[model samples]
Target: MWHDKSVAFRLVRKKDVQETGELEAQARVDRRTKNLTKRLQPGNIAVINHSDIDRVSAEALVECKPRAVLNAAKSTSGRYPNLGPGILETAGIPLIDDLGPEIMDIREGDILHIEDARVYRGDELIAEGTVQTEETIAASQEAARAGMSVQLKAFATNTMEYVEREQDLIFDGVGVPDVKTNFEGRHVLVVVRGYRYKEDLAALRPYIREYKPIMIGVDGGADAILEEGFQLDMIVGDMDSVSDKALTSGAEIIVHAYRDGRAPGRKRVQDLGVEHVVFPVTGTSEDVAMLLADDKGAQLIVAVGTHNTLIEFLDKGRSGMASTFLTRLAIGGKLIDAKGVSQLYRSRISNWQIFFLVVAGCVAIVAALAATATGHALFGLISTWFGDIVHWFATLF
Candidate 1:
């Protein structure tokens, strides 16, 4: 009794979905997008991979609007709390994950039936499958938890190596200056590389005069500062991504380093004849930027596009997210993530508009779908309707 009511649609790969899922989870963990916490909207079904359902974008499924989420990930075997199908259940979204890589092979316009999990390509049946069960979802949670532990361990090792190098550098007396900062009454803005910095900076132009924070750019952030037509008071980082103009922008330079005494990015500063000081430690350039501001007694540190999550570090091919995690901890009170500030302080889409758009879109989709009648009949109907409407308007005029 299979009905031919198939809906034509695009098939996104399970892998890509999983990657986004993990990114979402990491975003939540680092509190990068905390204002959007646990406010799941109804009737929006998100498709995700089981591997990414736990520590990363799991919060998305929990917070966003999703009626029933489709898990396009690996089978549940090991288990964890938030990683498996149980997470979906906890959030009241049905968990149907680990259908397999075979799902990736499905083509656009293929029909996927919910009751039996059978996929049909056009007029031909390709594969028959079943939805994941509760036990399998539990095992997936365990696997996710275990995997996170391994990733954290790898980060610890990387941090240790960085620390060892820092020790050696200190022995040679080639580290950051003990000079105190005198922002006593001046507004200080310590810029970092984090999300939507370009757009945020563009919107902040008018307010720049009001706050008047002395701009301190961290590495690539100097480029952003220059792009905003603002002078950089100081440029901090390894000096890898700062531009020639930023180097000569009359800003002080700071080179971040480890205990090994090697400042890899220092050569770039020297080549440009830029004055700089070495801030040697076991941390990322972002961390060094924050410390430089705090130690120098800056009024506030305003960060942007800085890697603040486990997934963000993984995206950069690092074993651990130690630097970012620790950096936030050290700069707790004075630090402010620009993303949160932007969302809260900046313009946002209104709830009424979102609802109106959703309703309008659904109506348009249904109307468009109802118009088709073997192509020929539909064209004739449209022509006749157009003529009648024009004739009626002409008569009225």
Candidate 2:
């Protein structure tokens, strides 16, 4: 499933590191890996400042096909077995760990040489860090598992705090802003650009067709829906990662604001002059989208690419994940994942339909054949054969 690590990641091999003078590539620097990835081109080196990088960020880096990743912070801080380092290693990308904050000083488009895991500009060596290998990543991940209990305990505490704070919104749906797009009595497809989202959304094409779901995209997920050529009805998120094209897409926007009503996304939406509402709730945007759908009386909420597991929530690296747990509990009966619906909800073709289709096909072939000149002779021969077969059967009986 992984490419050869020795291909580009041979910097770990001391002898081979000297064999290849140094791997030089253009640097794309950003404190945030996700933001940097948007501008990242193939073969460009990514310089980021993420600690214990999550799975989504790692996958984004891999998708950009970065030749190498130079992190300014720890890639895996032995915290809850975060899947980032392992993902980067498995993708054959060199993850140079914790080169220091000075690594961020490398300007975008600056050509840097990576020799024995040391980043140098021309004659000047700027930074040096550990060249993460498969063994190291695996070891870190194994050690990180012990921290899972700690993470879980913290998550439980946060969940309780959030539930207490948002009791009215969670239990009574007191402040869920109404959207123009009616979800009442309809199946709402809430898309989040999470694990296998594109693939899972593609898998739900037939479901989308049959149910004509009210498609809602959470953050960058709006672009995913647009990419699939589906008509997006509503978009729910902070409006940071989403494209301007999506904001101006005429979809009803519901900006998830902070508890105090500081809606930064509202300004962007207002500037676009599009119809939007701000729902000041203290939870993740995906949770808000689901809660809105459920509040609006959506018959069913089908989630695509949502983080469901303990590991996934941990990978998100946010205390807000507790809201997801509580949100699921709030609307578990009305909600289903895309994979679940794909597996359990078969296409609604009836047995009668299949029988009629077979019969119709046979009739069409027989009628066409009978309309020919040789058809009369063929029918006579068929009748004779049928009589002979019946006579033989009668004798056997």
Q: Identify the candidate with maximal TM-score.
A: 2
Task: Kindly list the per-residue Cα lDDT of model 1 for residues 1-397, writing each as its tens digit.
Answer: 1233434322222323311111110111111112222332444333434454433244445656454445445434442234424545555444455655554454322234332344444555544434444544555555566776766678778767654654343233345476434565555676665455666666666667788787878776788888888877888777766678888977887777654679997888888887778876766777676666665566677776677766467533344346666556666777777644555574478989899999999999768866776555776788899999999999998
Candidate 2 residues lying further than 4 Å off, grouped into runs, are: 1-9, 12-22, 339-397
Listed in order, each prediction's TM-score against the native is: 0.47, 0.82
TM for candidate 2 is 0.82
lDDT of 1 at 119: 42
For model 2, residues 174-252, the per-residue Cα lDDT tens digits are 9887678888899999999888788789888988999899999999999999999999999999998899999998898
Error of 2 at 163 (Å): 1.8
Checking candidate 2 for backbone clashes, the offending pairs are none
What is the RMSD, in Å, between candidate 2 and the native fold over all Cα?
A: 9.9
